[model samples]
Target: MITMQYRIVLPADYDMAIIRKRIAERGHLTDDFPRLAFKAYLYADRTAAYAKDRENLYAPFYLWRDTEGMNAFLGGAGFAGVIDSFGRPVVNTWSVWHAQVATDLSIATYATREIAPIAHHIALGELRDTEHARVQEDVERGALAAVTAFDPTHWTLLRFRLWRNVVEVADKNIDVYQVGHISQPSAKHDS
Candidate 1:
């Protein structure tokens, strides 16, 4: 099976009430794509602040097992829109792909190619910034060690974004570690 993770960050000035309403409305409409494994709305704790030192809003985490199907679903869902936050629009979308190991390396190789560009781009922009350098460094070191110790089949792509107003009001920064892998099919593995 394959897994794809998508993350979207709302703008600082976005209307939380309206956004939540819209999300709720769409959630009901997602029945159109029953293949979607999981969808989650995540918010920062009241005590956390934005990493970019801007107002914070809740971040949305979406997951799917059918890569091609999910992409097609999103492409036609009319999910695009702009929100006002802190008098500015600060929205972004990011995605990651994951696939299980089969007898061949084709799946992993394809995922690597499809996901590497976005990962590298985000790493260069957000992860490498001075504000996030330490965290990025730690992640890189850990990721390298993990990859070395285990096969790439166990690895998964993780994409995340930060929202300003949501972070500030919610008083919590975005939490990437807890977003994906929540709905692993394996019952024994409680991801």
Candidate 2:
């Protein structure tokens, strides 16, 4: 299976509350048609405390699956990029993992690759104007935890991509897979 990851920086003037509401209301009915695995709007503990106690106000981590269809259902809704309480542009990082080996090592490796591009992309992009922070470290930690904590045997990491816009898929990198990893059992073996 193939999955795409996107990280975007929301406009400073954007409204997060409305955005969350829109997401919940819209659900997975987007143009892309990708299945909604999970979605969260991340924030620091201090910020989270101040946030309105709403179920829609999630963290910065979200997962989507393409099992229902090949395309993601992100019709016209734009990605809810990072925005501060005051609606200022904040650096956002995201990664896509294509389950490759199904083994522990494979999952970990894909996770690392998934989050790595965010730092690189931000550094190469507008983030250069910002101060030096531990964004990379935080993303790395999150990616590590995601892969290590989740256990799946019948998965493989295939293609990884980082994007900002729903229309344009940017910075795509496809991972190599081993041969015969997904072969079907032979009928003769059933006897």
Taking all chains together, each candidate's TM-score versus the true structure is: 0.38, 0.28
Model 2 scores a C-alpha lDDT of 0.28
Clashes of each: 20, 27
lDDT by residue (113-171, candidate 1, tens digit) is 01222242344334324324433443343321011011144332333321112212232
lDDT of 1 at 35: 51
- What C-alpha lDDT values do all the predictions have? 0.33, 0.28
Per-residue lDDT of model 2, residues 108-159, tens digit only: 2112222222232243324322211233333343332222111123222222
Q: Where is model 2 more than 4 Å wrong at Cα?
A: 28-68, 72-114, 117-145, 148-191
Off by over 4 Å in 1: 1-13, 43-54, 80-191
For model 1, what is the error of residue 50's alpha carbon versus the real structure, in angstroms, after optimal superposition?
Answer: 10
